[model samples]
Structure formats: C-alpha cells, structure tokens
Target: MSRLYGDPIEVWTREGRPVQFVWRDRLHAVRRVVDHWVVSREWWKTSDSDPGERRFWRVEADPGSRIGTYELRFDTAGEGWLLMRAWD
Candidate 1:
C-alpha cells in the first residue's frame, strides 16, 4: 500500500456517497465502496486545523486500465476532499 498524504482531490458524490475522484492528475471511477465511516474532533488547537466531522470511504476504483482500492476523506469543516492512500 502507498500512502498519499495531504493529496487534494476532486470528488463526485450522489446522495452523499462518493462516486468518483481525481487524484495524481488522474481520474478514478469508483466501482464499489467497501466501507464508509466518520470521525469528528473539537476545535481547540490551531485555527488552521480543520475541525468538525470528516467522512471517509474505502472504495475500489478503475482508472481506465488498472483497478485499485483507495481511501478518501471529506472534511466537513471546510468541505474539502482528500485522497488519503491507495492499496496495492
């Protein structure tokens, strides 16, 4: 597995579930979501830190040629998306 830290991503969602995402200058279409969860924290440290709930999804995707399982997260405090890691 390869970890992609702080990788910005563009996600497409339907009914609050991620359907696709763009990462590493490539677009990956989600085939099936293996799991989904959430994590939340309070704002106490730095103002720059993203506070509130974050939604995460573990999905299998196809980047046209190869298939990969990826971990994606959405920051609720800022409504930003990130591609966390990819399973080899």
Candidate 2:
C-alpha cells in the first residue's frame, strides 16, 4: 500500500462504485459513500475565502451512508495537493 500523504489517491464505494467525493488530510467521518476526487481552477490569489480559486477534489459520502465527504485541494503555490476538508 502507498502512504496517504501528498500522494495521488483514488477512492470508491464499498460496492466498487465510482467515487465522486473530496479528500483532505484530516479525521473524517464516513457517510453513505467514501471516495476522493480532484479539483483545480484558480491558483494565483491571496484571498482566503476565494471560491474555486484552487483546485479541489470533493469526496461526498452518500446521504444514506451518512459517512461524509472528503475534500482535497491542490495548492499551486505549494506545488502539491493536500486534504482540506471532510464532512460528517
């Protein structure tokens, strides 16, 4: 297995379903689904509340699962991506 740090990873449902949620480097809860997605749009910005400024992958757990969504953000300034958020 590969380390889950600064590495490109893919997630899917327990039943082998296509994953469409986000992933971040934090403790997250599992909902109806579990997976990781990639997202990137803007990179050159100083604002913190900028929406879609940075690329991010959102892993949303299925509603029935009540797991949660995993979110990852690609930091152009940092030269890599990191886990940024998780839903519970």
Candidate 3:
C-alpha cells in the first residue's frame, strides 16, 4: 500500500543527497535511493524570478521498526523539504 503527503519535513543531507529525515516526529534513515529526478519548465527563460524547480528523491528508508519507500521533494525556490509519499 502507498500513501501521499505534503507535510513539511527536516532533512539531513550529505553532498546534496538526503541521508536522513524527520517526519511526524520520527527519524527515518535513507537506506537506498531508488530514483532521482527534477521537475520544472523553462522558468529561467521567463521574466518570473522564481525558477519553480523541484527535486525529487524516491528512497528506501528504515524508521527502526519497518522499512518503506518514500518520496521526498525539495523546493529550490523556497528552500524547503516535504514528505511527498510513502509506501509499505
């Protein structure tokens, strides 16, 4: 089963890669990165200042009791991290 969320989260990164994250007051360690991608249009060419680029990481993680896959999103313009989705 899978779930979706847009909750803000705190992440710890190493060399621009998420190594750990805190979601709903629990820490989840990133075991492996399943996929990585960027979602954005040609915002840089437009007059709008914000690039509107977002980076996404699909990762396998362990929260001590169980292991699951999660989708994490990083908003470059706002400099925030979000727990986008989770799988069990």
Candidate 4:
C-alpha cells in the first residue's frame, strides 16, 4: 500500500527530468525513473486558476541508504512540485 502526501517539495532536474528532491527535510536522490505520464483536464476552460498539464514521474529514490518508491508531480500552470505518494 501507498500513502498519499500531496506535500510541496523542492526538486532539482536534469534534462527535464527529476534528479533529486527535498521532501520533509530529507534529500532524496532519484536512482531510476520507473514510469512517466501526463494528465490534462478541462481543456476548453481557460479561465480557471489551476488549469494546465500535470506531469507525473514514478521513481525509485534514496534518502541516505534507504530506498523507496515515490510519485512526484509537476504542475505546469503553477510551476510547483509535489511529493504525491510513497510506498513503504
């Protein structure tokens, strides 16, 4: 099972892909990108404040020596990053 966080995170990218991220004061280095996808909704509605494509990356990351699976999200409209989920 996975736990949902939806917490804001600071991410560093390389060649448009996440290389590392800081979540809850720990720095997680991405070891591998397991999967990727994009989500776009309400295409015709432009007046909304939060309307844009959301890019998702499922990755294996390690903070220190413990590795874990994480899902990260990038919101193009807000230019923000989030730690969406984690597996234990």
Which segments of candidate 4 are over 4 A away from where they belong?
47-51
Tens-digit lDDT track of model 3 for 1-88: 8898999999999999999999989999999999999998575544477777889999999999888999999988788999999987
Task: Give TM-scores for every candidate, taking all chains together and pairing residue i with residue i.
Answer: 0.85, 0.33, 0.89, 0.91
Clashes in candidate 2: how many? 27
lDDT string for model 1 (1-88, tens) is 5767768899999999988888878889999999999887666732565557888999999999899999999988778998888888
Task: Give me the displacement of residue 7 in model 4, in angstroms.
Answer: 0.2
* Global lDDT of each candidate: 0.87, 0.45, 0.93, 0.94
Model 4 scores worst on lDDT over the 10 consecutive residues at 41-50
**Per-candidate RMSD, Å:** 3.1, 10.3, 2.2, 2.2
- The number of clashing residue pairs in each candidate reads 0, 27, 0, 0
Please give, for residues 5-74, the per-residue lDDT of candidate 2 as tens digits. 4444333334433344334333333343334344455456445654444455555544343554555555
After superposition, the stretches of candidate 3 with alpha carbons farther than 4 Å from their true spots are 41-49
Global lDDT of model 4: 0.94
On TM-score, the leading prediction is: 4
Tally clashing residue pairs in candidate 1.
Answer: 0
